[model samples]
Target: MKTRMLKIEGPRKLVLVEKELVLEDDEVLVRTLQSSICGTDKMYYRGEMPPNEKYPLFIGHEGGGVVEAVGSKVDEYQAGDLVMSFSRSCTFADYFKTKPINLQPVPEGLDMRIAALGEPLACAMHSVLESGVQLGDTVAVMGMGFAGQIMLQGARKKGATKIIAIDVLEDKLKLAKKMGADVTINPAKENLYQTIMGLTNGQGVDVVFEAAGNQDSLNACSAILKHNGHLVLYSWLTQPVTLNMHRWHQNSFKIITTTLVHHTKYERIVWSEKAMRPFQQGLIDVEPLISAEYKLADIKEAFEESVNNDEIIKIIIKP
Candidate 1:
């Protein structure tokens, strides 16, 4: 069958191209349902990523679809199964071929639109788990994007008594409050260090999550981390940023880098399954995070919105 897929020809340029599907023995063909734009996708769209030029590069990974066809050797999934995929199969398309192992069945009754966020949700959950948040611990999430929102909720679920959300955008700060952040901080207007110190009684928080992926946020995180505090790094920074290493060295901080996607396939499989339980139980709220949706044909406009709009937490593409 022929599929129409989005291809990136240059920075901020996208074209819909047709291609015939070729199924491998261990692969399955998925008819796309929902695909979402990620922060990395924005970087690629802006020509910030230095990985490869190779114009017409395939760009989406967070998506869900129904299996339309299965290879002869694919026994675990069939033609009608609803599945979430985490691979570079260029999911911004009507149909794509993927290995069965890269697909996870959406839980019964779960909305496929929300389930398409499995990849990012799992990564956020993994970071929360690795942070080792203890009961009644004071926690702070720096940045109120999708991952930050999810991380704060996960911290709350893990027994954080006082969860602080920090961001410059008032819209994100408001959403953070709605998502159960005990306190919200706007660093642009208030002194972030003084605010966090006052909130924590001058001791700082037990765990500080740096999700903003910038030098300013990193410095702010360092300023408010208590002695021996755990600093959880959750963002993917494409460029290098200056760090306050003196503070880290003096306070003996424990830095935990929780980039779950970098884990081995077997490890990710185990962790992703465990990470999804909270979502399955309805504890992790993702519905409010989906800020916008666009049809596949309007992908160019969708990319423009994602790049220019600061309030958009997530954008879903439906084909």
Candidate 2:
């Protein structure tokens, strides 16, 4: 079958091309219901990705869809089954072919829009779980993007008494407050270190999550973490940054990297299923984070808006 796919040809260039899809026996074909642009996708669109991961890349991995066809060996999925796919199989297309291992069956009662965000939500859940946030512990999430916003709710669920959401954008901080942050800090105007120290009585937070993927955010996260505190690294930093090892060594900080996508196939299946429970039970609210939606034909404009607009949290592509 022929499919319309979006390919990132170069910086600020998105080309929609038609191609024939040949599904192998181990693969399944999906008709995309909704696909959302991720932070990594924006990096690729802006040509800021690493040298090895260059464009003309097939961007986008966060998507949920109905199975349109299944291969002979794919017994678990059939046509019309709702599935959330976690792969770079070019989800910004009318249809995509992927193996069953990269797909998860959407649980009953979960909205498809939220289901499309399974990849990121799962990553946030993994980060929160691995951070080992204790009851009544003070937690701060640096960066109020989709991941940080989701992690704020996760920290709240894990029994954080004081959940501080930090970001440069007031809109994101406002949404974070609405989503259940105990305090919101805009570092652009306010001093992050003073505000956090004051809130914690100069003891600093017990756990700090760095999801902003910037050098300054990382440095700030390290600065405010308490002695022997857990510094959860959730962002995918495409570039290298110098760190202040003096503070980290003096405080004896424990760093935890939660890259969920690197988990084994079986492990990922189990983790994704377990991680999605909070969303099903209303513990995490992703609806407010979806800031905009655009047609697949307007992908160029969508990419530009996603990069230029600070108020935009998450953008969905309806093919």
Which one is best on lDDT? 2
| Tens-digit per-residue lDDT, 1-319, candidate 2 | 7989998898888899998999999999999999989998988887788758766778779998999999999998999999998877789999999999989999889999889888888888889889999999999999999999889989998999999999999988989989999999999999999999999999999999999999999999999999999999988888889988787888889989997877888888888888888888888878889999999999889989999998899999999
**lDDT of the structure predicted as candidate 1:** 0.89
Query: lDDT by residue for model 1 over 1-319, one digit each (tens)?
Result: 7999888888898898998989989999999999999888888898876544456698888899999999999998999999987766789999988987787888777777778888888889899999989999999999999999999999999999999999999999999999999999999999989988998889999999999888999989989999999999988888777887887889999999998777877787788888878898889989999999999999999999987888899999999
| Reference-based TM-score of each model | 0.95, 0.97
Residue 133, model 1, lDDT: 96
lDDT of 1 at 172: 94
Q: What's model 1's lDDT at 236?
A: 83
lDDT (C-alpha, whole model) for all candidates: 0.89, 0.90
Task: Kindly report which residue stretches of model 1 are placed more than 4 angstroms away from their true locations once superposed.
Answer: 51-54
